[model samples]
Target: MQVLFGYNTNGGQSVQSYGYYDPNYANDIRTVMVAVVAQSHVQTPQQDAPTKLQLIPAVPASQSITGESLPAVYFYPPAGSHNAQFTVMTTTVPVMNMIWH
Candidate 1:
């Protein structure tokens, strides 16, 4: 797997980030597709619920889909009591691509 992902995990706040298509492009009208796979995962905290949280990739520096890389950014509400960590897997819109065509 590509090593575009990164993490800032620790004892208290476990954060996982991946590198792939940026989320800012999530609304890009001309956008075509996006994909990424989870390389690692941290155990979930016993106190926090597994809500629908996601490791959204930061906005592309220059919105370049070629050559340069896009890094993922973790964004969690609160661990509550325990620490919950997870890696980002494939993140793309295949169905969306169909519509584009």
Candidate 2:
């Protein structure tokens, strides 16, 4: 039995994974790529059928911006008043998490 996993790093960084086969095995055989649907799917057995990639809704696609709309974030001066302290208002970004598995 073997367990394999992957994570990306820029080059020259430490490689971390747990498995038995040589990393070179990945190069000799054709790759089996499947669309990652969700975290729950990771534990699924892979032998039932052809290795498939399912595009599950991990994160909602951005429907709001589609060439005609402004981006979710923007910065500009405040309206209607001039200030003497000269400090610009700060902006905040919504926290985002991307699961690369």
Ten-residue stretch with the least lDDT total in model 1: 6-15
The candidate that achieves the highest lDDT relative to the unseen native structure: 1
Per-candidate local distance difference test: 0.37, 0.24
Give TM-scores for every candidate, taking all chains together and pairing residue i with residue i. 0.27, 0.15
Candidate 1 lDDT over 1-101, as tens digits, reads 22232222221122223234355433322322243333224555564544434455454544433334455544344544234544446443222333223
What's the lDDT for candidate 2?
0.24
Tens-digit lDDT string for candidate 2 (1-101): 11222222322222322122345433222112222122122222433322322222121223111212222222232342222112223222221222221
Task: Let me know the TM-score candidate 1 reaches against the reference structure.
Answer: 0.27
- On the 0 to 100 scale, the lDDT of residue 80 in model 1 is 49
In angstroms, give how far residue 97 of model 2 lies from its true place.
Answer: 7.7
